[model samples]
Target: MTAARRAGGPILVGLPAWVYLPAALGGLFVITPLLAILLRIDWANFVPLITSESSRAALIL
Candidate 1:
C-alpha cells in the first residue's frame, strides 16, 4: 500500500503526542500506593503472620 493508505490505517503520525505524559503519570499514580505499602511495612509482625517457612515462601515469590 501507499504511505497515505498506511497513514489511514492507524493515523498515529502528527497526533496528540502529549497524551503520553498524562498516561505515564496516571500509571505512576496507581503504583505509588503499592510502593508505599511495601516501604512502610512492619517486618516484625511477619513472625506471627508468617512463620519461618512461610516467610521463606514469600521470599521465593
Candidate 2:
C-alpha cells in the first residue's frame, strides 16, 4: 500500500483496502520459497509458508 502510493498508484479509491488482500497473499507465496532457499533447507523437504509478518497483518484485521 505504501509503496504503491509512493509510486503514484491510487490509494484505496473505489475499492477498500480489501482489494490488496489477494496481492498481498501472492506476495507471501512468492517470498516463502525464496526465504526457504536462503535458509538452505533441503529442497525436497521444503514446504512454502507465509512469513510471520504476513500472518500478523492478516490477524490484526
Candidate 3:
C-alpha cells in the first residue's frame, strides 16, 4: 500500500482542463428538461391538482 493509504489521508487526482466543458454541457442537458417541466407547471392550482384523488391514483400506479 502507498504512504497516503497507510496514513488514511485523502488522495487527490487532477483532471485535464478540456474535461470541464463536456461535463458542464452534460449537467446542463440533464437540468434543462427539469427546469422546463417546472416552468410549465400551473403554480396557481399546483397544490390542489397534486392532492386530488386522480393524481393520487396515478401516483400509486
User: Highest TM-score, which number?
Assistant: 3
Q: Which stretches of candidate 3 lie over 4 Å from their true place?
A: 1-12
Clashing pairs in 1: none
Ranking by lDDT: 3, 1, 2
Give the Cα error of residue 21 in candidate 1, in Å. Answer: 0.8
Whose lDDT is higher: candidate 1's or candidate 2's? 1
Cα error, candidate 3, residue 39 (Å)? 0.5
Better of 2 and 3 by lDDT: 3
Regions of candidate 1 where Cα sits further than 4 Å from its true position: 1-15, 50-61
- The best candidate by lDDT is 3
lDDT by residue (1-61, candidate 2, tens digit) is 3333436666543556887899899999999999988888555544433445666688788
Q: 1 or 3: which has the higher lDDT? A: 3
TM-score of 2: 0.39
TM-scores, all candidates, are: 0.47, 0.39, 0.77
Q: Candidate 3's residue-wise lDDT over 1-61, tens digit each? A: 2233335667745677788899999999999999999999999999999999999999999
lDDT of 1 by residue, 1-61 (tens): 2223364486434535787799899999999999999888778785676667877799899
